[model samples]
Target: MDKIVQFVQKSEHNATAVAIFGAIGVAVVALKALSFLKVLVDVFLRSGINLKKYGAGRGGWA
Candidate 1:
């Protein structure tokens, strides 16, 4: 933690770059987490459309 503070205080440009990249990294991780949660919800809490109703694999005029 102290090292990080020292590094940031070393230069304004370095601090800015670090802040930008950190925010981007945080956003990417958050998006990935949300996507994973959505997948879990889809798999366990929601049902997909029934393909049988559309005649998918019923040998109906492929």
Candidate 2:
């Protein structure tokens, strides 16, 4: 759409605003993924079983 293109052009011209918006977008996605992971961990913990048995291996990093 013309309006969408215009908006993108406008945003591109404003470096600070673009950076702020990009940071906000990344933060929102990170928070959502973390929340989902938390829920998954809670569910697995409640099941009283080791997730490793399901072929999930431990990472080398601490």
- Model 1 pairs whose backbones collide: none
lDDT of 2 by residue, 14-55 (tens): 656767889999999999999999999998876677877666
lDDT measured at residue 19 in model 1 versus the true structure, 0 to 100: 94
Tens-digit per-residue lDDT, 11-55, candidate 1: 999899999999999999999999999999999999889888889
Where is the poorest 10-residue window by lDDT in model 1?
53-62
Task: Please give each candidate's TM-score.
Answer: 0.72, 0.53
Question: lDDT of each structure?
Answer: 0.95, 0.79
Candidate 2 has which clashing residue pairs, if any? Answer: none
